[model samples]
Target chain A: MKIAIKLAYRNLLGAGLRTWLNVVVLSFTFVVIIWMKGIMVGWDYQAKTDTSNWQIGGGQYWHQQYDPFDPFTFSESHAQIPETFNENIANGDLEPSLIVAGNIYPQGRMQSIAIIGINPKQNVLLLPTQKLDTFINAIPAIIGLSTAKNLKLKKGDFTTIRWRDSKGMFDASEICIVDLFSCNVPAVEAGKIYIPLAVLQKMTGMENEATILTFRKNKMDQQKVDDWVLKTNEDLTKSIDEMIKTKTFGQSVFYGILLLLSMLAIYDTQVLSIFRRQKEIGTYIALGYTRTQVIGLFTVEGAMYSILAALVSAVYGIPFLMWQAKVGWTLPVDASEFGMAMAQTLYPVYSALLVISTVLFVVLITTVVSYWPSRKIGKMNPTEALRGKIQ
Target chain B: MENHSIIQIQNLTKIFPMGKSDFTALNNVTLAFQQGEFAGLIGPSGSGKTTLLNIIGSLDTPTKGTVEILGHSIGNLSAKQAANLRKEKLGFIFQSYNLLAVHTVYENVEFPLLLLKLNATLRKKMILEALEWVGLTDKVDSKPPQLSGGECQRVAIARAMVKKPVMVLADEPTANLDAANSHHILQTMLKLNQELKTTFLFATHDEKVINYLKRRIYLIDGKIDKDILVDH
Candidate 1:
């Protein structure tokens, strides 16, 4: 095998431009695939991080009737705060929020929204809830950039919000938008408004009651609380995982096409090598190689392209990928429009396993493709090959 | 000197398929070669001398009878055994100066020694010595395409002689060379055979090569028409 490798290396180098061209094409495939995969992984990592900071804190305990997808459940998904969490809540290690489905009228246009009440002093979530602490003639509130855009309301703008209280009686109040924050998480940004927890609880006639509890990351010793469902960070991020999985599967088709083109080039080169270098193959046999060894030599010769490509990729790919990871790949279009928790700029993440496995896969496939055409050598007559006869 | 015989052939025949009938490439031939004997199969183009050489070199098997090369029967040897025999004890030179075109002249000469798994220092020494024998020591780094016909043939000679095999087989080796290159290469082979006591066998119709042969076995239509021994 050592001798074979030596001879194959010499042969490939001797072949000159033809060999390098193949290496360049294969190397391009490696870089592109690895880079694309890295972007996807980086997006997954970024999306989950943003979601954790902007919305789900470390984890959440949802009231038994709290179905985020069903707005009707918000009316009943509340009860008096669990006394067990009072101390942590007071220490601000955990924050309790109440959700009430309501309608907002801005310039005579009514839009349904989720009116969420959060502690203005909570430090776990990356929200501008502190702005709710401002004293104003009207109720102080904050909205996401998307919601502010939809309502055509900016900071300091006043809008009337109407909702039903605990007894199903309708009530209305005016709120002054204290802030409009931007975030990557769509669930936290779209059609959502935040007001001081005490204010919303009082207005809804549900004081001292909460619909969900969000704890600081790694700060709480969690227990099974009655009438609530425990959701860990991993559980909260499952939707992102599922979405990324679908994207990966879809991208695999493009990956397959790219890989196929590169493999076909190698396969064609191997077959052509056999055709054009028949005399060399026969000379090898004449020099004392068995047909099997000649086949092995050809296969090794083809597989070396992948190794060369990897080295070549490392040459230019490392610097390019590093720069990309630092600056990130900014999507030309708005990613939030995709209706997912995706950032506008996504950093590519490359792991050792991703690079190693990709290289191995190409090498393995190239070896098989190279060996496929070389099998014809085993049935050849060496004497004819020596004469450069096509057999 | 009664040197041990390196090759023994008995009533050997080779048949090839052509259309619906079989073509007799070698018909009922018999011959033997001794170590240190510089001999040639002297014949016309279709007299089956090259076919007989191929059988003796273990590149081909006989259809009938047997050819024993260095104590191994050519008709019974497996592909691997034949290859091993060729690698360890046999050398072949083709008509077109079959030097690996992409390889440097030194690499071409070093090829057989590599197959023998010789150490690098030893392989380099033998390759240099062989190239020296062919007066190609200065052309080590030149590829075949860069070398003239005469130089390429010399590189081929260096390759065939590098391992100092028990027998060196030449199949019309001078067919592609001019008269000048032909004699130059033949003289190199004769000197190696005499100095190393290695057997030399040539299948040729070239008078230049035949003039250098100590024994000439003339072939006519795959049979030995005349076998003559000449005193030097």
Candidate 2:
């Protein structure tokens, strides 16, 4: 095997321009696959991190009747805060929030929104709840940038908001939009507004009642209560995981096409090398190489293209990948409409495993493609081959 | 089979399968070679000289009869064994000077020793010595395409002789060279044959090559037509 490698190396280098051309094309495969895969991985990592910080906060306990997808459930989702989590809530390890279906009329235009009541001083979530502390004539409130933009409302704007109490009695009140926050997580930033948990508790006449509990990662293991359902961090981020998984798989198809084209170049070169170097093949046999060894030599020769590509990729890919990691790929403003946790700029993250596995995959496939053509050498008649016969 | 011979063949017949009928490349041929003998399979095209050489070189197996080279039967050796036989004891020279075009002249000559798995120091020593024999020590870095026909053939000779094989087989080794270049190549082989005492076998109709042979075994229509001893 060592001798085969040496000879194959010499043979490939001897081919000069043809060898380098194939190497360059294949290097592109390495860089593109790794770059694209790294982006998906980065997006997955970024999405989860953003979601954790901005909204979910490691885990959640939702009211049994509450469903974020079903706003109608908001009418009955709340119950008294369970006594079991009271200590955690006091220590700021867990944050309890109340949700009420509401509509906001800004400049006589109405927008259906979720009026979420959050603690004015909570660190579990990255929301600017401190902004909810500002005292104003109307109830102080904080809305996300997307919500503010849609309603054409900004900070210091008084907006009329209306909702029902627990008894189904209708009520209306004014809200001072104290601030608008920006975040990568569209779900947290879209169609949602925040107010002081105490203020909403008083206004809704649902005192000491809550709809969901958000806790710091690993701070609370308490998962079950009579009317609450536990959701771990993984559970909250399952959609992002699935989306990235699906995108990665789709990217693999593109990778397959890229690899196939590169492998086709290698396969073509192997076939042509075998075809054109008939006399050389026969010479190898004459010099005491077994047919199997010749086949192995060709396979090694073809697979060496990937090794060369890996080296070539390192020449240019490392700098490009490092630059990309430092400065991320920015998404268009329209990407916010994805309705999931997508950042404005996504930085790719490449692991050793991703690079190594991708290289091995390409080398293995190249070897197979190379061996496919050289197998003909096994059944060749060395005498005719010596004479450069077509067969 | 002769006990004193390194290569012994008896009634060797090789038949190839044409589309509908068999083509007999070698028909009921018998021959032998003692060590250090300068010999040639003297014949024209279609005379089966190359077919006989291929069989003796263990590149092909006989349809019938036995060919024992250095105590190994060509007819019975497996592909690996045949390869070992060729790699270990036999050297072949082709008509068109089939030097590896991509390799430097020195690398071309070093190919066989590499196959032998010799140490680099020893391989380099042997390669230098072989190149010296062909007087190509100066052209070590020049690839085959960069060299002339005569230089190419000399590199091929060095490659063949580098292993110090028990026997060297030449099939029209001088066929591609001009008369002057042909003489130079044949003379190099002659010097190596005498100095190394390696048995030399040639399958050629080239008169220049035939003139240098110590023994000429003529073949025609897949049979030995004449076997003559040249008093050189």
Candidate 3:
């Protein structure tokens, strides 16, 4: 095996431009594949981190009647705050939030929205909840950037909000948007507004009641309470995992096409080598190499292209990838428009597993493709091959 | 088989499938070669000289005969065993100088010893000595394409002689060289044969090669017409 490697290296190096051309192509494939995969991995990391900071603080407890996908359940998903979690809430480790279905009229254009009531001093979420503490003539509210954009509402703008109390009585009130905060999580920012918990309780006639309780820590070891369901961090991030999985599947098609192009070059080179180097193959047999050993030499020769490509890629790719990881690859368009957890600039993260697996995958594929064409030597008559006759 | 013969052939026949009919290359030819004997099979094209050489080199199998080289029957040897026999005790030189084009003269010559799995130091020493024998030590770093036809053939000779095999087979070795280069190549082989006592066999109609043989076997229509021993 060592001798085969040595010979393969010498042969490839001595082939001059033909060998380097294939190596360059394969090296390009290596860099691009790793960069693209790094982006996906980076996106996954970014999405999870943003979601944890901006919306789901570690974990949450939802009322059993609450179905976030079903707005009609918002009317009944509220209950009085349980006494067990009040101590944690006082310590700022737990935050209670109330939800109610409402409609806002901005400049006479009505937009249906979810009115969420959070503690004015809550620190579990990165939302500007302190903005809800303003004392003004009208009810103070903090809206997300997307909500403000859709409704054409800005800070210091007064809008009419209409909703029903727990008794099904409809009421209307003027609300002032004191702040508009930007966030990567669309679910937290789109068509949602925040108000003080006490103000919302007083307006809805549902005092000390909340539709969900969010905690600062990730653990869910608390005993089950009636009418509340625990959602762990893993469960909360499941949707993001599914989204990334779908994106990765789509990206794999691109990865496969790239790999196929590189492999096609190698396959072409192997086939051409077998055809052009018939005398060399025959000479190997004449020099006492069995046909199987000749095939092995050719396979090793082909597989060495990947190793060379990796080294070449490292020459340029490492710097490029490192720059990308630090400065990040910015998408041409706004990423938040995709309507999921995504930042404007995604910093790529490359793991050791990614690099090693990529190299191994290319090497394994190159060896197989090389061995495929070299098998023809076994059927060749060495005497005819010595004459450089095509078989 | 003769006890003193390094190569023994008995009623050797080789046939190829030409379309739907059999084409005979060698027909019922019997011959024996003693150790250190420099012999040549003189023939025209299609006279089965190369066919016989191929069989002796274990590159081809016989149809209806046995050929024993170094006590191993060529027809019955498996692929690996034949390769091992060649690796251990045989060398081949071709008319077209089938040196690996991408390798330097040194690398091409070192190839056979590499198969024998010799250590690097010994391989280097043997390679340098073989190149010196072929007068190619000065061109060791030059690839086959960079060398002249004569230089290429000399490199092939060095490669064949690198392992110091028991027998060396040359099939039309001087067919591509000029009279000057041909005589130079034949003289080198003659000196190596006399000094090393390696059995040398040639399959050629080249008069330059024929003139250097100690024994000449003439072949016509796949049969030995004359086997004459010449006192040189």
Best by DockQ: 2
lDDT, candidate 1, residue B39?
A: 95
Question: Residue-pair clashes per candidate, as listed?
Answer: 0, 0, 0
Tens-digit per-residue lDDT, A1-391, candidate 1? 8879999999999999999999999999999889999999999999999999999999999999999999999999999999999999988999999999999999878999999999999989999888989989999999998879878999989989999999999999999999999999999979889999999999999989999999999989878999988999999999999999999999988988999999999999998999998888888998899999999999999999988988998899889889998999999998878899999999999999988888899899989998999898998888888889975
Please give the distance, in angstroms, between residue B43's alpha carbon in candidate 3 and its true position after superposition: 0.6
Tell me the alpha-carbon RMSD of every candidate.
1.7, 1.6, 1.1
DockQ of each: 0.80, 0.89, 0.87
Q: Tell me the spans in candidate 2 whose CA falls farther than 4 Å from its real position.
A: none
lDDT of 2 by residue, A79-172 (tens): 9999998999999999999999998899988888899999999999999999888777999999888878888999889989999998999899
Model 1: residues with Cα > 4 Å off, grouped in runs: B1-3
lDDT of 3 by residue, A32-60 (tens): 99999999999999999889898889799
Instruction: Provide i-RMS per model in Å.
Output: 0.8, 0.6, 0.7
Higher-TM-score candidate among 2 and 3?
3
Superposed by TM-score, candidate 1 places the C-alpha of residue A79 at a distance from the truth, in angstroms, of 2.1
Q: In candidate 3, which residue ranges exceed 4 Å CA deviation?
A: A218-222
- The alpha-carbon lDDT assigned to residue B218 of candidate 2 equals 92
